[model samples]
Each structure stands twice: as C-alpha cells, then as structure tokens.
Target: MVLAAACTALGLWQLDRRDQAAATVSTVQANYDREPIAYDPSLFDTYEESREWMPVEMTGTYDSANQRIVRNRPLNGRPGYEVLVPLRLQDGTAVVINRGWLPIGNREAGHPDEVPQAPEGEVTVTARIRPGEPVLNRSAPEGQLASIDLAGYGAQLDYPMHAAAYGLLASESPAPATTPVAPAKPAIDLGPHLSYSMQWFAFGVLLFVGFGYAVRQQYRLDHEDELDAPAPVRTRRRPSSEEEEDAILDARGL
Candidate 1:
C-alpha cells in the first residue's frame, strides 16, 4: 500500500515539472518571436529583461582599429578566438560586437593582424539581446584594454546610456567578410526528463516492496526453525563392568 502511494505521488510530481518546463519554454519562444525592435537603450528596464533571445537591429559603423581578440572562444565546438570590434552607433553610443571565431593567424605574416578593421561608414548590425557579464572574483588581463569588470564598466558607461552587451555576435557587415550570420535558436525537447522522473519513482516504490518481502521471508525462516527443532538427547555415562557384575550376584543369592 505504501509503495503504491509513493509511486503515484512521484509520477504526479514529474507531471507538474513537465508542465512548468513547457510553460517556460513557451514564454521564451513567444518573446523571441514577437515583433522585432530597433535597438533602443530605454526599451530595457533591467539586465534580466535584456538577457533574452530578442532580435536587435542597430545602425552603426564598426571602429575596426580598436578591435581586440578575446582568447579562448569556441564556436561549433571548435577552439578559436572571437574578433571583438566596437560598434559606433549613429547616436554616438558604443557597443561591442563579438564577431565570430577565426584561426589564430601567424604573427610573422601580415595575418597577425588578420581580422580587418571596420571601415568608417554607417552600417547595420542585427544581433540577439544579452546582458553584460556579472561581477566575479576572476579578472581579465591588462594592457590590450582596461580590466574587465562588468559592474564597473556599466557604471563608467552610465546606467541610462548603452544597454547590455552580449557575449557573442554574428557580425552582419563588411560584405560577408567579417560578419557572422546568426542562426535561429535550436529546438530543445524536455520529454526525457519527464520519463526519467517516472523511472525514479518506480525504483523508489520497488525499494519499499522489496524490503518488505525480505523482512517477511526472514521472519518465516526463524519461526520454522523454532517449531521443527529436534528433541534434546538425555546422554548418560555407563557404569564399570566389575561394579555391574557384583550388583547382579547380590541380587541372585548372596
């Protein structure tokens, strides 16, 4: 009875989790697929609001001269570096674009400065919305640019200024030379988790039933031993032969 109740409860709990996950995925998909918006800093009230999959369009020119290569970025599961160039918007707002990965070019060859600098002209940039990195114990290296402290950087930019900067960008300019064309978000299914939850519940139920069966079997074995035990033997020592013969003679006549 207890095992059945536990399994039923667990199965119900997984169902609830499945519902919640589906709801969350639906909300996110809806937001991402909603109307496209031009990059307006004021549209975002907080970092969390901006850290989502929304289409962002901006009219900006890349400042290629100030480009920096962020080391250790992986794309398509391959190790490479991302080209980081600043985007100078029409309203004079500066946003960093994380252009896609490129091979670490040879320093001796002119390829050392391999990625091209953005030409000084107006260009359009479209990318997914994201937030600035949070403050943490680790710090970026120095000399190439100022140390990377997200909070401090945001403070320097002034809260009301530019919105959040994302960690990755598909460069949309330089005539397909440097721009990365963004791909649609991949579809993810959560069905396996629900199934796993059911499996765990079943295992938990079996635990209870198996334990009860084992205990009952042990009790039966102990009871049977007590009921079928052999009668205790009354073992006695034998008398000496000479003593036995003398007792026989006295009984006969003497």
Candidate 2:
C-alpha cells in the first residue's frame, strides 16, 4: 500500500510538470502562426515564451567590427558558422542579429575571414521570430575565443547590449545558389515529460500485481498440508508401558 501511494504521488507530480510543459509549447505555437506585433525588443530581454515567433522589424546600424562566428554550424548538411552581429537600432537600442550562416573554409585558410559584412548606418532589417541561442553540448571554455556565451560575447566586444543572445536577421535568408538552410529558432520541444508520466504509472501497476501474487502463494502454501489430514485428538497422548504399570500399582494402593 505504501509503495502504491508513493508511486501515485510521483505520478501526480509528473502530471503537473507535463501540464506546464504543454502550456508553454502551446503558447509558442500560437505566437508563431500569428502576425507580428510592434513590441519593443526589450520585451524579449528575458526570452519569454509569449514573444516567440513574433515577427519583429528593427531599423539599425550593425556593428561589424565585433562580429562573432558561431562555429560548428550546419547549413544543408554543410559545416558552417552563424554570423552574429550586433545591431544598434535607430532609437539607440542594441539587439543581436543572427545574419545567417557562412560556410567554413578549408584548413588552408582556416575559418573564413571573408564572410559578408553588415553595412554601417541605419539599415532596416526583418528578423523572423526566435528566442535565444541553442545550448551547445560542448561550448567554449570561459574567456576563450572559439565560441562564447551571450553575456560574455557582449563583454568580449565591449558591447552596450540589450536582451537575448542571438537573433537570425531578416536580410540573411539562404539563396537557391547556396546551401539550403533554415533560420534558427528557440528549442521548443515539450512532449517528453508527458511520456515519462505514462511510464511511471505503468511501473506502479506492475508493482501492485507482483505483490498480490506473492501473498496468494503464501496463503496456498500454509493450507497445503492440511487438505488430507484428520483432526487431532484434543486429549493428551496415552502413557508408555512403564507408566501404565506405575498407574496400576498406584490404583491398588501399593
């Protein structure tokens, strides 16, 4: 019973997590398929789910001097780097733009140094809706230049930045002549928690069923020896030969 209760409590806890995850996914989906809202990019400084897929337009001058190359990127199965440049909007707010991908060159030239340059001055650009950078499995070591965290990226470049780590810029869509690629978006998968809840519930049932079999086996074994036996005498057992003689002499008062 205790085991069953504990399992049930755990199942309930997982269910709660499942619900929260579903709601988050739903909110993102709704935001994605809808039209753009003229919201300040500040709303996404913290990467809220509601702001996901909200198509945003910002007119800004890009800072190309401090551009970053997101290494180990993939574009249509080709190895590449995601060009990251900071955009200072007309109103003086900074937002990071993921200006699409750049195919990494052969080791002869090392990483490509001839990636497209973001023009200076106010350049109006559109960014398809997205959230922060993907969590890389093996990111660069602290303060190392290979690949850096968003905050550290800003710090390394001496940036006066605002909100989120990455944004795929509108002007950088893949062309037919180049490797096919899709723009980056926040990681939004949320079904695994619900699947886990089901597994826990199934395990709880198996525990109850196995315990019942054990109890039934014990009961059957306890009663097995009695099926063919007669009832035992309630009185004490009869005396042996010497005891009987003693009893007879005592009866004659010897």
Q: lDDT winner among the candidates? A: 2
What are the per-residue Cα lDDT tens digits for candidate 1 across 1-254?
A: 66677777878888888887786576567656666567876433245553465666777777666566555445567554556566676676666665655654566331224665454677777666655554555444431222223345434443223445543453365455544323446465556658967786888778887989999988888798776889899998887999889889889976
User: Candidate 2 residues 1-254, lDDT tens each?
Assistant: 77877777887888898888777777767765566455375654777666656667666677877777777777668776776778776666577777777776765344754566676566776665455653456654232234435666666665467646345554532222442234655457776777677777877898989999998888888887886588887998889999999999999999
Error of 1 at 225 (Å): 1.2
Candidate 2, which segments miss by more than 4 Å at Cα?
1-6, 39-41, 44-46, 71-81, 101-122, 128-148, 164-166, 170-180, 184-195, 227-254
lDDT of 1: 0.59
How much lDDT does each candidate structure score? 0.59, 0.66
Any runs in candidate 1 off by more than 4 Å, and if so which? 1-24, 31-35, 48-51, 103-113, 142-176, 180-184, 226-254
Q: List the residue pairs that clash in candidate 2.
A: 98-167
Clashes of each: 3, 1
